[model samples]
Each structure stands twice: as C-alpha cells, then as structure tokens.
Target: MARNNWIAVASAQHARRGCAIPERGYMQVCHGKRAPLQRVAPGDRVAYYAPTVTMGGKDTLQKFVSIGLVKEGSPYPFDMGGGFVPFRRDVAYVPAQETPIAPLLDMFDFVEDRSRWGYKFRLGLFKVSDADMRRIAQAMQVDLALLQFESLLF
Candidate 1:
C-alpha cells in the first residue's frame, strides 16, 4: 500500500503517572478523506500521549484523539471515529523521543516543566504517513483526517 501521513488532536491532559509515563493521550490520523475528530464532552475518558513521526513530510496525515475518550479495556478492530479505524492494541502511547517536527513544534508555546514536555498552545495540524498511521493507530487509538477539524478543544 502507498505510504500515508497521520495527524492527531487532543482535548485533555493525563499527567498522573509523572515523568516515567510520557503522557498517553488519544489521537487520530488521516484515514482516506475526512476531517480531524475531537472529543465531545469535558469528562470524556480518552487517551493522551506524546506522538512522533517517522522521517519527514513525504506524506501528510491528521488525527483526532483526546484524553477521557476511550476506556482502558476497550476492544480492538473497533472504530475510533471518522474514517479511521484502530486495532485492539492501538490504545495508548508514550512518545520515546521529542519528534524533530521543528516546523510545527517551533510554532507551539511550550513550557518546560518537571515532566517530559508541555505545550502552552495547541499543537495545531501535522502530517504523517499510512505506515506511520498504522503504527500510530496501533500505539494511540483515535481517528484521523485530511480535511479539517470537526470540533475544537476549547
């Protein structure tokens, strides 16, 4: 299959585990031709994490997944919403390294806290690939899009 790009959106925070747990937040990626998906309610139990890309922007992708959206023991092969679908193991993730997405990362107002990393502003939009999409979906459960945001975080 042709390589695909991925993007993810978050609406909540999960820093309970401290630095060891690099934040596992729900996120989605572009699945065909759709818009970014976001959580509906505030108390929604979704996932959160520090996502990363493979190489660079050879391809593009957009994802929508936030904290308090999905549950812990949820099943796989389940639809995350939008056109994106995730496998069973695609539940949560803890980014290993700080992704070299300088273009996008530079735009954010990040605050260096005691933990890993924190962004003062939203991450906005990003790009990824299908292989990366599959990998991200497997790591962080959420939907993706190539169009626009279906909703906003705040």
Candidate 2:
C-alpha cells in the first residue's frame, strides 16, 4: 500500500500511553467517534503531535513525540472496560525525540503565519504534504525512507 503522510494531534498524556504500547498500536481520537480516522489506510505514516508540556505526570516538552506506520485495520472502538471507548486505528509506533515545531514552522505550507503555526492542529487528524512530512521526520531524527510514497508526476 502506498503510504500517505498524516499528522494527528493528541494531548501529552494520551500520546504517551499510545507510544508506550506499539504492538497493539492505536491512535485514539474524538472519544471513540470516527470520521477522519476512517479515512486512514494501512501503511500510512503518522506523526503524533502533543500540544501540551505535560501529561499523566510525564513531561513531553510540547512537541511532536512519536511516529508510526499504520497497521492493517480500520477504525475500531475499544471498550476500556469502563464505558470509555475511543475510536482508534492500529499502528506500529516508535517514540521519537521531542522535536519542537517552532523551528520548522517556516518549512511547512500549512503554517502561513509563523506565530500561529499551531492553528492548523485544531483539526485532530489531517493530511500533510510529502515535503512537510519529510521535514518533520528529519526534525524528529527519524528515517522517512521506511515509508513508501506514491509517485507524483507533477
């Protein structure tokens, strides 16, 4: 499958737990509601962005915290056994070095204004251009070669 690059925003706390469990990799969003997640496909490349500095007693430094490869699955609701079910997609995730988005703001087309780079993140899950994805992967010090991208003739 061709890998489509994606960015998903999560709170530091949730991002921490999601990265910790890579085997059963799941990116939960919208309290179990599915919309954008349903559009995600297997083999897609996902970069997780944490907007806050700390979560669940862990300090994330407010940065892009993890990267993952989507596994073979569709959006499914997992019952946490406490009436807490969140829609999620299976992913093979790896914790990444904290890369603050501030430095790379100018490199992304999604960020029109340097001071408001975060405005785009309001949409929890969204597609990112291959260039932006590569830049983000570079900033996180992760290898983007692992993801296979569809060729663009233009």
Candidate 3:
C-alpha cells in the first residue's frame, strides 16, 4: 500500500506551549522541542488541533464527501471520529439533499448534523513541503504559527 500522510488534530494546547505532549487526552499536540518537522515524512506520526462542529464549526465530513475526498462505510482512521475534528462548514461539505433544508441548512445546520451521517476524509491535492508551509507563512509574514495539527505517513 502507498504511504499516506496522517494529520492528527487534538484539543491540547501543548503544541503551542512548546510541550511534547498534552497533560491529558486520547491524543497529544504536535509541537514543542521535539515537534515533528513541518512536513510529514513517508513513515512519521504527528498531531495538531482542528475545528469541529462540537468545537464550533459546521460539519466537516460532509465537505470531504462533496469533494469526493471520502467515501461512506469506511472506518474513520483517527481516534474520536465523528467528533472533535471540525472543518469549515461553508467550504467543506455537500448536501445530502438536492438543496439542504432552509434554516436547518444554515451554517448552524453543520452543528445540528453532528453524528447524523457517517463521514469519510481524504487529503486533497495540496501535498506541500514543510518549508513551503513555512515559507508561505513567512512571505505572508504572520506569526510563526504552527499548523493546527500533526501528520504521519508510512
């Protein structure tokens, strides 16, 4: 099988504080002294933070499905599946119906649909380098922000 880069998103703040691991949680942040380099190598593992409906965002999984990035009936690879990991609702989803129900389909619909449908995810065509991510951040000139998660591929 081909190796895939896996991005792990967690709620822990350890990554921002420069800690190797969070004090508690099923997963740890990917930051700090031993922070995995920017790019996920073919066989490395890492984690980061991501938004979820539970965390105050729309249904992220639906976005994956609309983009044809994920398929149904597949086991979610990351822990805390169908929860925790939230993506931007407007940018990341497809409606189950030809047109989503009004009011219900509003941005908040993402929040309501929590656990309503099975979600699958796959990375898009953005295989960028750590240096690239860094350079972009640098060129745009923002805080030395770490991506919200870590990823491993083997």
Candidate 4:
C-alpha cells in the first residue's frame, strides 16, 4: 500500500512530550483512541499540529510541533498509571523546528476555508495530501529525503 501523510492535533506540551519519549518512539492520538492509530501503518508519515500550549488551555501556540515516520507495529496500550491506559504507535521522529501555521494557512489545499481552517483539526487526526505534507516538512525544516529514505527501510 502507498504511504499516507497524516496530521494529528495536540497541545504543544503533549506533542513535545511524545517526541521526547525514550528512543523517540510512540505517538498517541485522539486522546489515545485506538481507532485513529489503527488507520496508520508502518512507513506512513505523521506530523503533529498544536493549537495551544496545553490541552484545553486558552494559551495559543499554533505550530507544527513534530514530524516523523511510523515504525513497525500495531498500537499497544500504555500504562500511564492512575488506571489510565492509552494506545500508542511506535514512531521514528526526526529533528524539526516548531513551525507556526499562520503563514502556511494559505498554502494548504486541505484547509478549504482559510477563515475556518481549523475545522478539520477538530477531528484530532486526519490525512493530508502529499503536497501539503511536503509543504509542512519544509515549514518545519524537516528533511524530506531523510524521511523518505527511512520510510523505504520500513
């Protein structure tokens, strides 16, 4: 199957936490819902967009915080203690800057309505066009060639 590009919405703090996890592995989406993670496969590209500094917070910080390729494996439950377990998928995150989305708002075809571009982000996780993905990678200062090469190995 052809690889797909996905955009996941999360808070900047959570997105950064996902990237900082040991081995640069694992991402949980849609509040750790397994259904969303199940749609992703090994080699697929994943980028995280944060609209706030903290979950449910008013502090705005719209940015593309993390970009990486999904690693081999199905989603597995992770014990966060407090009886809260969330499903997570392994990912090989790459180096990238936290890029703002304001400038790129007009560049994304997926954002149909620039004024209400955030509608899709409400879905938590969704697929994006390859063109949009490339544009995001560029905005985030991510090396697409490296991501492609890494994807091929999976």
Best by lDDT: 4
- The per-residue C-alpha lDDT of model 3 at residue 44 equals 23
| TM per prediction | 0.22, 0.85, 0.21, 0.93
The positional error of residue 119 in candidate 4, measured at the CA in angstroms, is 0.4
Candidates' lDDT values, in order?
0.31, 0.77, 0.25, 0.89
- Model 3, stretches more than 4 Å misplaced? 1-126, 136-154
Those runs of model 4 whose alpha carbons end farther than 4 Å from true positions after fitting are 149-154
Q: Which candidate, 3 or 4, would have the higher TM-score against the true structure?
A: 4
Residues 1-103, model 2: lDDT tens digits: 4568889888767877887866776787655678888888988888888887554346545588888888887888788887787788888875567689878
All candidates in order of TM-score, best leading = 4, 2, 1, 3
- lDDT string, candidate 4, 15-133, tens digits: 88999964856799888899999999999999999999999999999999999999999999999999889999999999898899999999897989888999999999999988888
lDDT by residue (115-136, candidate 3, tens digit) is: 5422211221223334333332
The alpha-carbon deviation from the true structure for residue 4 of candidate 1, after best TM-score superposition, in angstroms, is 5.8
The count of backbone overlaps in candidate 3 is 11
| Alpha-carbon shift of residue 122 in model 1 (angstroms) | 10
Model 2: worst 10 consecutive residues (lDDT sum): 145-154
- Rate residue 4 of model 4 by lDDT: 96
